[model samples]
Target: MTVVMVEEIDPSSADAGVPAHFGDPVKEQRLLETAVGLVDRSNRDVLAVPGDERASWLHTLTTQHLSGISADQGSELLVLSPHGHVEQHAFVTDDGTTAWLDTEPGAGAGLLKYLEMMRFFTRVEPRDATSEIAVLSLVGPAAAELLPELAEPRIGAVPGPKFAAGSVPPEATAIYSVRPFEGGLARRVPLGVDLLVPRAAKTSVIEKLGVPRAGLSAYEAIRVAARVPRLGHETDHKTLPAEADFMAAAVHLDKGCYRGQETVARVHHLGRPPRRLVLLHLDGIATDHPPAQGTPVELDGRAVGFVGTGVRHHELGMIALAVLKRNVADDARLTVGESTAAIDV
Candidate 1:
């Protein structure tokens, strides 16, 4: 049987907007936890870097140590400003010739421009590949079983930059699969693979996969519960990698000189980041909508932080991610709008 598609599907997805759910949000969440769940991430932007020097070029641009990233390997990179503030975030995988990058919506243009401006004498060429490719995230207990090679590769899960290409739709030239890291909050969420396929073959591939399609409503709730920080939500131009807890995953402390290396080193060695990410447990007794993003978080009437993404977790009730002052105690009582909340670092 073929997987059914929504009749009036929104291609741009502007009609449904974010947090759009198909079925019961809780049920969809459970689907991701127990079985396979498919999430259409076409709303995300993609950039393709094609050239002989793509890997070395990007290696010097971002914090990840890309020299070790051979074929079928990948890494998450953070583009920082000269002051060591996170300006962009992307997951990168290289196919020897082309470096494929997946970034948050509306962030591709800026990244492309930055890459172009700094292309003094490098042989790399970066182009927007959003129209050429589409992204689908498959997650659940069965995900590894569905894509065995991606989960358990023969060479012992190539450490540096893990990526693989496989057959999907005939029209789709390649299916790039990335394995999620097993650390941090990822340990609490279901392990999965992120598939990047040709734009024209997205529907065919999804239908052939025969999995329930989950929407942002289910994804956002689980993302908050897992304490995973997104680009637009928990990060901005002023956010630093260390402050977002991305130091271990995205930044390299011992790498050669990069644009923001000075600031990163200074912050890491002596100065502490003023703000840090925390999970907020919102008071469920409130009869109104949970605190919106950017809501002020106060400690005993003094503003201490700002709320990021707030969602109703199926099991955890109303919870949110917040960027709070480092001085704030982990058990501090916080007030958001007319509601009360507790902090978890």
Candidate 2:
């Protein structure tokens, strides 16, 4: 078995309390936002589903249009509880014979267990591939140009667009790339492209690509700016897919019955989610540090919602994403830590 190795860096280097950075958080963020940046996403977990019933079985499990996705295409998935609360979020891709599912660190084991419990008589089989497979991410305007240089998939040349995707060409092996942001009409200049590579080849590919390494700070900034909600940060067991703004990317309204279809339908049609995710433009000049996760968000001196991920972008200044009451006005002023911030909805 191939073991994925994670190279650890000093935690108290750049932003002491924040996640470690490669070198300078500002420079790394600038690279990700302007030129190009790469991150070792091997820390994330991957689950492989292989068998004749893989496609059909997964289709009946999550909220996404998987039946129509081609062998080279991929989509994000939201695994909701029976009451529509989020249980898991995964990036899923199929290669005709096998389906690859990726999730946040520490969440894979639980996801595998859930899959097993619900599998019943289905022909699908789920196996943990985290030890054998690793993921790398590329971001910025230069991401597209740098993809073909890595591993040219059988799909041929990548299409022109900041957010474009397709399967790796069949002749290729060991690695593959996917346009994680493109999902039908929700087109936008995505944060980056994701490359799924075998664990044994991760180090070699990183050296071969020769892109600047970005740490968690830069990654968090870009993700928050893009309004991407991560598992523990923006989502948890109490979270509803609608509240996290995952409906567009991970939910398929026209799909057949799944775990939490009724609750999703009810919320989308008649009810309003208790809370909604929003980006906050913090008063960096007045704040000493970025608000930590679960920090209180006070409106008019009353607690409403709590903070999630916070980052200071190279050019964008201090920014954070928070889940606030759905009724909170778009222009409402909220307080975080010792400083005030505004919703950038």
Q: Estimate each model's TM-score.
A: 0.83, 0.82
- Compute the lDDT of residue 242 as modeled in candidate 2: 79
Backbone clash tally (model 2):
6
lDDT of 2 at 70: 53
C-alpha RMSD (angstroms) for model 2: 8.4
CA lDDT, every model vs. true structure: 0.70, 0.72
**Which residues of candidate 1, in runs, are more than 4 Å off?**
1-19, 152-191
**Cα lDDT of model 2 overall?**
0.72
Tell me the deviation in Å of residue 22 in model 1: 0.8
What lDDT, from 0 to 1, does candidate 1 have? 0.70
Q: Per-candidate RMSD vs. true structure? A: 8.5, 8.4
- Cα lDDT tens digits, model 2, 86-200, are 9998888776677888898878998999889878898888999988777777778788775443323222232122222233222211123343322211111246577777788
